[model samples]
Target: MNQHDFLIALLVFLVAAVVAVPLARRLGLGAVLGYLIAGAAIGPFALRLVTNVESILHFSEFGVVMMMFVIGLELEPRKLKNLKKSIFGYGSTQLAACALVLGVLAALLGAPWQVALVAGLGLALSSTAIAFATLAERNLMSTPAGAASFGILLFQDIAAIPMIALLPLLAADAVGAVPHGPPAWQTAGKAVAVMALLVVVGRYLVRPVLRFIARTDMREMFTAFALLLVVGIALMMDAVGVSMALGTFVAGVLLADSEYRHALEADIEPFKGLLLGLFFMAVGMSIDFGVLAQAPGQVLGLVAGFVVVKTLILALLARRFGIARGQWLLFGLLISQGGEFAFVVFGVAAHAGLLPPHMEALLVLVVALSMVATPLLLLVFDRLIAPRLHALSRRKDDAIPPQHNPVLIAGFGRFGQIVGRLLYSQGITATILDHDPDQIEFLKGFGFKVFYGDATRVDLLEAAGAGTAKILVVAIEGMEDSLALIDRVRARFPHLKIYARARHVSHVYQLKDRGVEIFEREMFEGSLMMGRRVLEGLGIDPADARSVALRFRRHNIQAIDRFYPHYRDQTKLVSLARQARDELEEMFRQDREQRQKQEDAEWS
Candidate 1:
């Protein structure tokens, strides 16, 4: 395209993305689907705003490569090794099972065996971009379902290389001709040799070069090197006919132990996000709407049929693998769509004559439509299904034995434990209630008496002697929970004095609103102590440091009290805070001058 056309295309893409992504997210569909929808609307089949879909898609596939590299950076060699069971066990089983079932279904539908096999393999792969995006967006990447999904996707990326290699053999068989490529053994050897070369280069060469670049302290240069590394690896992998993503992923893992890993990730992230978004849009643009129009029922049926089959298979695998019951359907639906690799696979198959043109077009539409359907399906599941499952899965509150201790602690975590221990040391025992069963069991092993129950529940609070207890300690970790417990105790047991833990200044205001006079901002005293020590380290007299800390604490407490009435007004709150800071500084300056005068008098 010419410069003008390129600029126009960029403008259209940016405008579409800006308009579509937020709307999709506002509607709870997600940004991936938004990009896809934007692509489809401006694509040739729709608005005809852009016609060169293939070139854009080819360039944007590097986004997948970059994403894999970033993901690999998170998995150290040890962690990757730890995932062997999931990668090979669950991953291998899932791929084999899905391929077998889908391939059989294809053959049963009268597709030639070669075409059927290729189709099954292509469709068995799930969209890594979509799955990872959803998982990361939901912050589920650390969950069991996320780990399992990653393992499956990682395996699929690795497996796609061989699948691509298999195309020639399959094509040759289909056409009753001898295979034209180098011998299978030679190809395998070359792949192995290339991987070994990468390992050697990454371990010996890449780190030193990165170290040299980092010493220059040019952030842009570091970013440039990071991109150069990925691009170079991709080119090398493509030359060897290996999956560029897999190659870059290995490079990332090799650098996982490097100090530059975070820097590399930070540098590469923007490129990855943009490219991945572009990749999704390209998938959207590539959707063969003409093929859909030609055979709508067949196309829609294939999309629905394959998705249901894949989801059921994945759900069963999740159960077998002992993924959380609540996440079983989630794990399935998150990855059931035909992946981006399918586009490449089917395209290759068509070129090699393994798949006929009409069938290839149909398969492409099926994959794209399935990609479009995933976010919608997940939105429905999240809105309708997940809440009910969560409700059913919630553990019942543990029974609390009757207690009459003078002190009732709502949470026995770090903050409450210190209070409880201090009270116990003084021969005063408090009744402690915590909701975390694991913590309670562990603490019980240390001979501490603790009950497992949500303290916000009035019944549990009463059972823990909140009504008769002289003091109720609201030390729950969650701000909302602490506030709720304070409200409940104040309402139910008005005679009880409450000592709450405030997480921050906002929390202090909230506690004050609830009439919690004995509350402590959790970090205030410790921070003051640290500040005093820091002053001493800076050559200030010890006595002066202590006085300064004490004075600062008193000033802060007075400031909090003054700020309370205006807490609901952000403008007033900020203004008062700034004014208080200046006043405190002035007070400190005067104290310093007074101390100097006192020293002068003593010396005289």
Candidate 2:
């Protein structure tokens, strides 16, 4: 396309996204659907605004690659190792079972075995972008269902590599011709070698390069380097027949422990979001509305058939894997849609004569419609089904026996455990209530008497002796949960003194607003201590370092209180922050001068 045409297309896309996304989000649908609707409206079949759909679709797929890398950055090698069982077990089983059932059904319906196999494999895959985005929207990524969904998606991405390779052999079999390509063993060897090289380079070489770039203190340059890393890894993987998403994900995992991980994520996030939205738009444009118009029943039926089949299979897997009963439907619906990879598979199959042109178009439509359907389905479930399920679970919740412990501790994780242990050592046994079943089980094995119940629930709090307890410690990890517990206790038990843990400065502000004066920022003390140790290591006297740390802590607390009223005003907040920094520095300077004068007087 010419420059002018390209500019026009870009303008159209930006306008459509800006207009439609908020409307969709406001209507309880998601950004993904909004993008899809925008794409369909401007597509050749509708408005004929931009007709070059195929090229745009292929280009926008890099968004998925960037997303995978960001996800990998969150998952260190240790965490990935922990997911091995789920990855191979649930992932492999889900893929195989879905493929077998779908393929067999297709063959029985009179499709060629090759076509059936291709369809089965392609349809079995689910959209990683859609599932992750939806999971993140609902803040469900840390839930069991979310982790399991991630494992299945990761395996599917890895499996796509071999599936692509197998396509040529399947095509050759159907057409009675020898496939012309490198032998399977040679390709496999090259893939393994490329992966090993990426690991080595990512582990040893990338950090030094990133550190060098960061040292230059150029934000744009650092961002450019981050993009270069992803694109370069993608090219290498594509050359060796590995999935680009998988390659970049490995690079991300390698850098997960790097100090620059957050910087890299921040740099790439905007590009990833924009490009992913464009990718969804491209999918919407590619949907064969012409075919849908002519054979609406066929298209709609296929979409329904595949979604239902996949949902049932995933639900069974969720049950067998011991996912919470309440999450079974959620787990199924989240990933039952056809993925972006299906477009590539079906297009390649059509090119290789394994599928006819009409068949390929039909299958692509099915996949796109299924993608569009997922967000709507999830919306319905969230609005209608989820509330009822939650209410039912609340009704069936087990009761905790009333206790007379002097203290009540909620959330017995690392933070709460320290408090509990210290109290226990001092001959004070507090009643502990933790919501995580796994944590409660593990703690029980250590001979600790703990109750498993949600602390946010008023009944649970009352039963745990919030009414009679002298002190209530709100140590829940989530800021919202901690604030909710504080609100509940302050409302019901006015006599109880509540101590809360704040996740960050903003959390402290919220807690303070709710009248919680006794709150500790979870990492503040430890970080201050570390800074003091660094100062001591830098040749400062240990006692002086201790005094400086205490002074800084006091200054910080005063600053927080002073800034509280202006926190809502960003301009005033920034000005006050600058003023506070200058005041602290002036105080430190005076302390140093005073200490120097004392030393000189002693020497005289």
Q: Candidate 2's residue-wise lDDT over 1-604, tens digit each?
A: 8899999999999999999899999997989999999999889889989899999998999999999999999999999999987888889999999999989988998998899999999999999988988888889889999989999999999999889888988888777999879977889999999999999999899999999999999999999999999999999999999999999999999999999999999999999999999999998888878999998987899899989989999998898776999999999999999998888899888888899898898889999999999988888899999999977775334467779999999889999999998998899989998877778889989777788888899887888888889999999888887887888888889899988888998888888898889988889999999999999999999999999999999999999999998888999999999999999999999999999999999999
TM-score of each: 0.91, 0.80
lDDT of 1 by residue, 414-479 (tens): 999999989989999899999887799999998789998888999888888887899988888999
lDDT over C-alpha atoms for residue 6 of model 2: 91
Stretches off by above 4 angstroms in model 2 are: 22-28, 69-84, 108-110, 132-144, 175-233, 236-241, 250-270, 320-322, 394-404, 408-416, 432-447, 451-531, 552-586, 599-604
- Each candidate's number of clashing pairs is 0, 0
- lDDT for each candidate structure: 0.91, 0.91
Task: Show the lowest summed lDDT stretch of 10 residues, model 1.
Answer: 390-399
Q: Report model 1's TM-score to 2 decimal places.
A: 0.91
- Give the clashing residue pairs of candidate 1, or none: none
